[model samples]
Target: MRTKAKRAGIACAISILIAGAAIGAPRDVPTGDGMYANIKTTRGEITVRLEFQKTPMTVCNFVGLAEGTLAAAGGKPFYDGLAFHRVIADFMIQGGDPAGNGSGGPGYKFPDEFDPGLRHDGPGVLSMANAGPGTNGSQFFITHKATPWLDDKHTVFGRVVQGQEVVDAVKQGDKIEKITIVREGAAAKAFKADQASFDAYLKDSGGAAAAKAKARKDADLATIAAKYPQALKTASGMRYLILKKGTGAKPVAGKTVSVNYKGMFLSGETFDASDLHGGPIDFQAGAGRIIPGWEEAVLDMQVGEKRLVVLPPELAYGERGAGGVIPPNAFLVFEMELVKIK
Candidate 1:
């Protein structure tokens, strides 16, 4: 009789494990008290509570988009029919572009609203995706895991209260049927009334500023290419001059690499140096954490290799440029020495 009871208990435990695997564990509400947005997707629904007190501007902009009161994608609901264009497992899911591509936006841009109290502490974080500082638009992303690296870099507007199971199940090409604000915040209503004036302002200055920046970048790239005639060029337009040939393992994706690097502009002014930090900076190759040019440049290198890499504006910071340090369309030069690949 004892043996039969023990077997039944083991069978029950196995069934519970199977059930748990099918449905993910529950996630806590975004905040103790706040506004929430219910996002319906093909997989399921996700609820995110907006941090109105912390990031009022960001929350208001998101609310206007969700409610279809503010102009977006021809003044219609922008998120509907849009797919989660970029999905990196254990990282985040990105969408909110009407074009389903990273380049599209609401035909207008807004400045970033920064808040020190908010952060990317765990999964289900809702933050605005921008080209750089003060370039917030319609694109936003939701984290599926802890991403402290994104803190202070992007605006954190909301957190997921329910449907994290849906978030975890979301994959690339999954569609966000629509997103609706569950409880309208006061901030959203105020921004709704100011939408017209804001639109007019962006229309007058945004495009003109962008055009000027592009022209400047083009000139910079031409100057950089002429100065580094001996550097080998890749099809992606990245140029590099090998300073030292390495005999160790060739770097590939998913490998953690340690390297010492000095970043500078064409004028020879140094912006950042890892040697001063006492040791090499370690990061995962091709993780999208670093600039695209640096990633491509390091992939061709082996441990103990040293190279001078020149990156075009598009590959480095592009038209948006880095905050204060790197200008728009400015070509960047990096002196990199790969210490090891772990």
Candidate 2:
């Protein structure tokens, strides 16, 4: 359990909340052409118009939780007493954990719904928070400033339709007294019905049970090692096997390198890949821009070299794993190909 620093682009930005007294009464907002969620906090009310047309899955999931239609173990409202667990004044304000802690969720997870149309243009943008890709849960955040870095990384389900002042004034530990869904728009009702059906089906088929079981899977390092018997092991527990030897010089500190890589869990579940979006990502070789394992491993590789690297959690995300995708003490596998060094 080493002390882990927060990653710059990681979405596990929400922190656990410390319980506090309420600041205001719960209230509702008048709905308009679309689905609206009036989030009543201790300070004031902030109304957001959900974008079901663009991100239907995300909007429906949120509405169901708010209406108490999506119950957990005992069937209770999810956001009634939860506080804005984490709040970074210029970044975003996060909440929606019933336990007031960032660790709590709706007892299940769902896939991410990404839409290029929606973006973090300015303040009042509402988006789902996750540990990584396809791990959307109940936690959400409202931005106070434009965050282009978070555009496609998180699901933008809704935007502040009214009450920017309240959103700006909110702080951590301020209670979310209630979240009321006003489906005045036709789109809202449609999404609400769809989500209800989805939740009911999940309850009937025990989808959450299956998903939880999958998440608790054992590490796949043994399987990978047996598959790649020729891999070399390092003193730091990092393992690697060269795929393609380079023709140019090896990269050093302060030199930038561009590479294509695919990162996966020991379970063979791919967590990220540069190919998924488009091209390779460039970063300084030993500038601490990536995980310690990557910085150290890539330093020895030359341009055009490709290697399969295996890393222990200690050298990766460690105790505080990246949100939900990388669990505690998890092992990882990466196929990295260096394209250029400058």
Candidate 3:
């Protein structure tokens, strides 16, 4: 969780690691033409326009989960009685978690589909909520207002065509009665919300390419490990090299600390730096305000120490990498110098 000290503006670039694969391109449909979901919740119905042309696989997954066509749903409507579970007053209302707590899904996950044309520019935008990149399950959220910071980090697969008031009125613990898919026109009508259809869609949209990318990334990580044979390995799969040792006090859980860091990929391409954000960034240790990798590494460092830390995807952003900078399942390398502990 890198702090957003500097906004990237409208160019929140995202790089999908599936090289040369035109993922999410609609197969026999025109853009702007897709199915709708009539979500009947405890409050009221929120009609969402599914972006099938832009994010076909995500739309398929949502439709399949709603209609019980995907095997993960056990052949029953999955959202029939699920709670909204989480809500933030000025941010968004999240739901579709079967566990009613935010950790449950339909027993499977899928890759993310991001369309540059779609954005969280205002209220009523519908997006997937996941633990990380490519971990999209059945959980979703609707914006209560513009959420520009989320752009490129989450998949924007739908938008509310009607029921803004209902979306705003939704509260935590509100149950969704059922979600009915409404198909219109030839393109939307021809689509099938079944597991096979989704599989075909995934195949057509660079599933093989994704596999190749994973192989390349794995090989690169192995090479890095071999190169840094003496690097310290943490219990959580992180590796680091202490470049400079400091004799100052180590930061604790409640202490606020500041650091200057340069973030890069395994290829040595810099993605972000503290200087880009004006100066050193600060956060309280162990507060969950930053990524697990940063939290763990910083806590082990002294005030004036510097380290070259390598974070695996699970400890960084998981399958969902950060905006156009970090790719999915990427290995993040950071040169961090702890500046102060306040």
Name the top lDDT candidate.
3
lDDT of 3 by residue, 52-151 (tens): 8888889999999999999988899998999999999989999999888888998877776778999999999999998876788999999999998778
Tens-digit lDDT string for candidate 2 (1-342): 123444532334432121111223344565357788888888878889888778766776787777766655235567888899999978999998766768888878876666888998999999999877567889999999999888767899889977777888898999888787777755556555345575654464356545643564332565766777898999998889999998888888999999899999766779999999798999987888799889878898888899999887778887556755676556789999989987
lDDT of 1 by residue, 200-221 (tens): 5456445755775677767777
How do the predictions measure up, each by TM-score? 0.52, 0.54, 0.60
Rank ordering of all candidates by lDDT, starting from the highest: 3, 1, 2
lDDT of 3: 0.85
What candidate 1 gets wrong by more than 4 Å, as runs, is: 1-33, 73-75, 184-342
Q: What TM-score does candidate 3 get on C-alpha atoms?
A: 0.60
Each model's backbone clash number: 0, 2, 6
Look at candidate 1 and tell me the lDDT of residue 281.
Answer: 94
